[model samples]
Target: MTYTARSIVWIVIYLLFILLPLFALLAGSLPPARDFWTEFSAALGYSGLAIMGLQFGLTARFRYVTEPWGEDVIYHFHRRISLFAVA
Candidate 1:
């Protein structure tokens, strides 16, 4: 699949805003206190996993692109993320 520059930028922004924090939680690397980090990480990880699953379901339902430029870019990112979630 070919990714446009807009799609790449949106995906990067999505990762920064959504995925990065979740990843830190999953890794128990979010700072301040190590003891609490693990528990917080566990909780956030579960929530993040649930959100990811929901996104996957929604994206998988979209078999074709029908939106305009920005929305289409978002769908493309969603499709890519859905694939990553499956893996």
Candidate 2:
């Protein structure tokens, strides 16, 4: 499938959250320090904000479809990621 810009952004998110963090904990040997909770929380917050940004873009760019099947796309992605994570 040809990935559009929206797909690219979420692919980046997957890299940042699912891939980078995984490596950070394993290969990187990065310990969660005393202030790790704050850092981790901020990272999570950024991830959420990224999703919000995508949502805003999706709404602005696809208002017609957003009115009809927008949420289905979101759920579809969510389900795909869920299965991906499970694998």
Candidate 3:
């Protein structure tokens, strides 16, 4: 695929990785329903963990993965997302 296509594919994969855990959690048996903020907070916590975990892959410098976006852009995204995940 072209660079743009590869980049889009990677973006989709990243989103799926982050969301898969939330989906799995919802799919399984759960406790009684809670307030909206409580559920929202839980979802945010899961997403943050996923983002933080993916940082390792980002910094691994896989040529095919980084080629589409360039190492600089990838690192920039990594830094920004790290901050976001922390927040």
TM-score of each: 0.34, 0.36, 0.94
Question: Ten consecutive residues with minimal summed lDDT in candidate 3?
Answer: 24-33
lDDT leader: 3
- Candidates in order have lDDT scores of 0.57, 0.54, 0.92
lDDT of 1: 0.57
Tell me how far the alpha carbon of residue 70 in candidate 3 is from the true structure, in angstroms, after superposition. 1.2
Model 3, C-alpha of 50: deviation from truth (Å): 0.2
lDDT of 1 at 18: 57
Q: In candidate 3, what are the lDDT values of residues 8-74, reduced to their tens digit? A: 8999999999999899898989757799899899999999999999999999999977899899999
User: In each prediction, how many residue pairs overlap at the backbone (N, C-alpha, C within less than 3 A)?
Assistant: 0, 0, 0
Best by TM-score: 3
Residue runs of model 1 more than 4 Å from their true location after superposition: 1-34, 62-71, 79-87
lDDT of 2 by residue, 1-87 (tens): 334655676556645654454444455555556597886765565545545445444445455434434667766765565454434
RMSD of 2: 8.4
